[model samples]
Target chain A: MDIVVCIKQVPDTSEVSIDPETNTLVREGVPSIINPYDENAIEVGLQLKEEHGGTVTALSMGPPQAEEALRQALAMGCDEAILISDRAFAGSDTLATSYVLAEAIRKVDSYDLIICGKQAFDGDTAQVGPGIAEQLGIPQATYAVDVKVDENRIAVKRLLAGSFETIEMKLPALITADKHMNVPRHAGLRGVMAARKKEIPTWTLEDIEADPEKCGLSGSPTTVVEIFPPQRSHKTERLEGEAQQVARQLVEKLREAQLL
Target chain B: MNIYIDAEKCTGCQLCVKACPYSAIQMAEGLATITEACTLCGGCVSVCPVDAIIWEAPAVEEVDTSDYQGVWVIGEVGEDGLAGVTWELLGKGRELAEDLNTELSLVVLGDEAGELAQKAAQSGPDRVFYAEDPALACYRTGTYTDVISGLINKHKPEIVLFGATEQGRDLAPRIAVRIKTGLTADCTGLEIDPEERLLVQTRPAFGGNIMARIITRNHRPQMATVRPRVMQRLQSQPEHGAEIVEVPVSFNETSIMTRIIDIAHDEAAGQVNLQDAEIIVSGGRGLKKPENFAIIRELADALGAVVGASRPTVDDGWIAPYHQVGQTGSTVQPRLYIACGISGAVQHLAGMSGADCIVAINSDPAAPIFEVAHYGIVGDVFEVVPALTEIVREELGSG
Candidate 1:
């Protein structure tokens, strides 16, 4: 029942803002938290640990500041936390990312299950979970809403088009959990106190024996050719009137625009 | 890789023919012959008693794949038929096809693709391909990808586009993995670079703080999934049609790992149908609390529009996840969009900026939402919302 949860520190997507003049993210003041989905992944791991009596270890890759996110996982009942961070891991796409994360999981070797959030809020790419699964050569179910574990098999209810499908796969498979699978438990004060005493380990690409060729932007297959602001037309026509009249004006405007 | 039949030892039980998911095997004179439609999925090789069928998984590097030309859209057929995104892709695909000076093909994979494919051919594609069967009637990642990727491998299309729906998001990455190609997800803009003949995929990054323009360097048939409603559909010309190529389907049950045990749709909850809505009235954090969502819904009903929520509102549990409109939720490009109490974050605006007209109602004079809005009203929601609702109720009642 040993489990590994992959977590990430992401900027609060809600607070993230673009600087209109520079056309860049105003990253300085925005708070970073554990990715919302990854928090659910941690919850799934802790719940599994509570039910099956196994340790839940959190794994993440980011700069040193990301250890704060790992500490948050520690506060939520993870037994151990590992952070893989170095300048080499910067600018990695999903392909290179899953490679590094999979290598970290392989180093942990004793795990029987791996869980991840369906997607990162910032990146919004749901590929990394399945990508890690494919890299590890195991069956995977993505967008899982509910899961039940048996000795050798696990049944998952995965969300799909207009419906959810239940799937069964052998143990040692990966699942990318969708939100609302369960309401994550709040970390108790006791857990928070214990987290300060826990030692969080840091791993480097060399420690994981990762191919330098495959660890970063250099090893990545896809590249971001350019980044720019999407063109927007802010030419707003103002219509102000009394409250009751405003709605009528709106309807009339819709008619005038041939949109009614 | 090649798939062929050794008809010499073949017993014409038609087992191999029945097992071929792509209907690539045909019985000729009591012996099975592999057709050009074979996707080399090895669906038939296991079923052959006489060892008559053989398939080799292609070494992606060995295949020239250069012969693959044309921009193809994977037609997503809904329960009834013809999802709007198909026509939208057709509209965009037409331009890409013209730029490449190649043909445009669309593959319709569904439970009943014949009708769907015919419907698609009328959209003015050069060729319309269909692979349909009861196994593929609803989308199983295994079944749909088996049939669709098979067609892609056989045809080597230069570029492929998919609607970033639930099915498309689920299926696209798997196909990209299987076919050994790169996929760009949630692309808002697509264009063919005539110089090198690359598909330029533009999508937001860091919650729309920046938009990344991406291109797959070596992959043949660059794949991308665009959110539905982001592009305009081509005008339907029932009088026009294209060449329809029907690919036969015979799927084996064992190859599929998952089954539809039960279907639980949120439709009973009557969530907002933002994906197809012509108009969307969305609320942001400025609505103040979950109970205030009723105001947004009231306005939506007045205009026969759907209720949409910015990511913050949905994150606050003010509305169901389905009502969310942003990078994390559904991207909607309606005919008209109205925002209330929304500050217009880059991510929030990215989703609905494609609307023909945008109206923003926020008290903050400098709210970013004002930038993209075609109309603006700086006022208090408490006053403005109730007034708008009464007006809508009276106006619609009179109409």
Candidate 2:
């Protein structure tokens, strides 16, 4: 019943803003937090640990600064934390990132299940989780809103368009956590101090035996050629009146637009 | 490829120099100049009003792109029949195919897909592929990917498109990984390069703050999953039948990694009609809490519209996820979109901004939602919603 939760630190997407004058991201004062969805992933792992009496480990692949994110995971009831960071992996895309993570998981070598957030807030790409499952030749269920675990298999309630489909898979399968899987627990003082006592392990690409060519920008099949703010040219006709009067005007406008 | 300036068209605007985040653009003698440090992010191209910047990349190692043929869309099952996004993709996909001088094809995979395949072809695909097995009835990541990847290997379609729905999002990436291809997700715009015959995918990046135009260089059978409702559907339903091909797949249900036990629906069924609704009323985190959503519901009822929620409200369990209208939720292009207490996060804006008339009601006049709104009311939702609802009710009663 051992579990590994793959997590990432991302710019708090809500606060991240673009400078109007520069037309570039004003990343200076933005805070980095464990991706909003990954907190649910961490919560799901801890819940499984509490129910099944197994150890939960948090894994992340990012810069050295991401180690803080792992410490936060430890404070949230994980037994151990591992940070996989290397200069070679700086520009890694989903495929390359999954490769390093899969290799690291093989190195950990004791897990029955792996969990990842549905998607990172910044990239908003739900590729790496399935990519890891594909790389490791295991089954994966993405966008799981609820999960129940036992010694042999895991049952998941996956979020679809309008309904929740209950799915079951054997051990060693991967599940991507969706929002509201569980309310992530806030770390208390005792847990925060205990987290400091735990030694965090750092792994380099070479430590995982990752192929150099397939580990970073060189291996990524896609590249970003152009990125610019969405050009929005909208002019609104403001309605200024008491609420009731404004509401009447809205109906009149809709009538004028032939929408009614 | 080298970046250059068209001096004739240059208006001596230095905006590009300031727009370059990398300091790659310098103002040289009152004209913008590109430095060697330029990453070619196309920042200057967007800022240039006179179209003065020329960022050119010559056709590199032209290996007859014509070898790639046929535009393909994966189909999904909906309540009555095929999903709306499936039809939307087919409609948009047909344009891409024609631009490339190729045929538009479709593949429907499910437990029982023979009928679904025919339904897919009714959308005007040149050929329809039914890769059916009982195992596909509910999506198991492994089996679905293998079957579609196998079809891809055999048929070798040049371009493949999918809906950014729950099923398509889950299946498309797995297929892309298995077949060793690149996939762009949540695309809002798609076009084919007439000369190089590459799929040009335009999608929001960095949480909709920026629009990224991505191309997978040297990848065969370019793949993209377009968001629902962003594309225009065909005016007429398919009057003629299309060619159908049944793709053979060998699989045992037990061999797949996952099995679906049951599907449970959330309670917001009747109110969650954001996709097809001609008029929609949506609320956001500004509703304060789940109970306050009653204001949104009341407004929707008075207008005879379906109720939609933003991502935050749904994530907070105030409403069902299906009722959400945003980047991660259903992209609705309703004729009239009334947003209450919505500050309009970029993701939310990307979803519903395409509506014919967007009315935003937020107490904060500075909210970004006002930028795209056709009508902005700076008033409290508590006050505005009730007043609006009563007036609408009275207006309708008078009518």
Candidate 3:
């Protein structure tokens, strides 16, 4: 099995904060890390490779800085890394991103399986994986927590809002990894050194033979017309007292407000 | 499509760099440069005081949309008949359709599609299109996409709406790609652009830190998956009649690439649908230990509320991921939400902030959760949760 795990570098949204004064996101000093789910996807790929005996390749589409994320994937035991970056790819939505990625996966060719994070933390669309599968004309199982390969088929245990469903699909399919898939392992020193020395090629839109029209904002159907801070209520009624007293007061307030 | 900086108007204030959510703009040689990281969100365009950052939007090929009419909502069927989200979508779909002076239609696909569609017609859609087959019952991506996309291609609805549930998120994008159209995800707001007759979609990005209003320009059947619980469901009216259309599902079963092996519905794990719950009591890392979640459970029991968990708690194995309330987990809009020990991260807030009333209890007085909670108690969860449970048990006579 040749596994290709798609990854993305995202700003640590947990550390991101808004400036109360300017009402804008304080992006300064915020660190960018490999999306959490992508890390799990890489782990799934590596584990599958170990069990089934195949090479694992980590792929990402972002600026040059995103190569750092791919290197981390390699350090975590990926056999190879590839970065698909191009200026024309800027302003791409999930659809365009999937198109470019699907094209790149086609170029990778002869792959048995493709894995992607359930969704990027920042975008949280959860569309790219399925979109890529559709563009590739393959089957996909999203929010997969466990996957087991058997010969030419794989069974995926997927998570839903209130249930877990196991879906079986043929090879050369796509599966989006959920956070519960597996605990990701940290990169070892030897692996890090080897990854640093390894050559990871960067592919552009032209290299993937993607239609320029479907590569970026041009291919994107949705456009952001406005951006603003989410409105938040500042007024909070504090119940200042002992725990017992506060609890009583809360109950009383709830009763008075007809919320109890 | 051209994005360039006007050298004459550039003052290199670097505001765009700070304003950019993606950090796509940078100062190089005292002039701001747009990097490949830019998603063309046009965030920097507005922050530039000199208007030096110019974004020439790409020309969209003209599509004759006059042939496309009616607003169609993809109704979902869950373990319980028609999902509440279907009614919610119909409620909002009615408004949009009314605004556009078009008909509102509901498309349901399942083994009981006819029954579900009939049940949904009470919500007052002008039309209901249903495709029935056992193969369409369990929501295989291939069959669902084929059937819906086939219907969409045939009917040419001007706009399509879907609930941003797991099934919707999985099926909408595939259908959109198959039909060669754009589909926005998890929109919190949807409205019709009166002049252009476009769907204006507003959704949170960057984990609810910012809101982006999006539009599918020049695309027919402007499609978007709306967040559940955000839209209100209209009262069912028996007097309302709908034109029912039966769709024939045609697809090769052998051509389907996936099969459902088993569906294990863990009642203990996700028995309580957080989105549908009226009250939710959520625990966080501040609960101190995994075992301490019992206190939250007790409180939820006393109040007849569902138990929810913050991401940290779920990630720490203190609770199941199904109990998680946050951006990456579930976006819920219950009537009352009680947060215990949760520090109120933006991710968590993105989910339950829509609750009608919020009560937060934390030992730390400065926790961000207090900022959004309508009622705040600066006390330990161990102390406050049990006390509140006792008081509520007595007050509500639920003990």
Residue A254 CA displacement from its true place in model 3, Å = 3.0
**Interface RMSD for each predicted structure:** 13.6, 4.5, 1.8
- Could you say which candidate leads in DockQ? 3
Alpha-carbon shift of residue B73 in model 3 (angstroms): 0.5
* Cα distance off (Å), candidate 3, residue A257: 4.4
* Native contacts kept, each candidate: 0.44, 0.60, 0.83
Per-residue C-alpha lDDT of model 2 across residues A1-260, encoded as one tens digit per residue: 78999999876656666565565665554677898788989999998888888789899998776888899999988999999987667556676788889999999959989999998877787888988988888888888888888668888888664567898898889999986477789999999999988999889988998887776665555656677677767678899888877877878898888887
Kindly report which residue pairs in candidate 3 clash with one another: A91-B39
RMSD to the true structure for each prediction, in A, is: 16.5, 5.3, 1.8
lDDT of 1 by residue, B121-190 (tens): 8767889999878888767666777788889988889899998877787778777766656788888899
* Tens digits of per-residue lDDT for model 2, B239-270: 85789999888787567677778888855643
Top candidate by TM-score: 3
The worst-scoring run of ten residues by lDDT in candidate 1 chain A lies at A218-227
What's the lDDT for all of these models?
A: 0.77, 0.80, 0.89
Better model by lDDT: candidate 1 vs candidate 2:
2
lDDT top scorer: 3
The deviation in Å at residue B245 for candidate 2 is 1.2
TM-score of chain A of 2: 0.94
- How far off is model 3, as Cα RMSD? 1.8
Candidate 3, overall lDDT? 0.89
**Model 2 chain A, poorest ten-residue lDDT window?**
A20-29
Task: Give residue A65's lDDT in candidate 3 (0 to 100).
Answer: 90
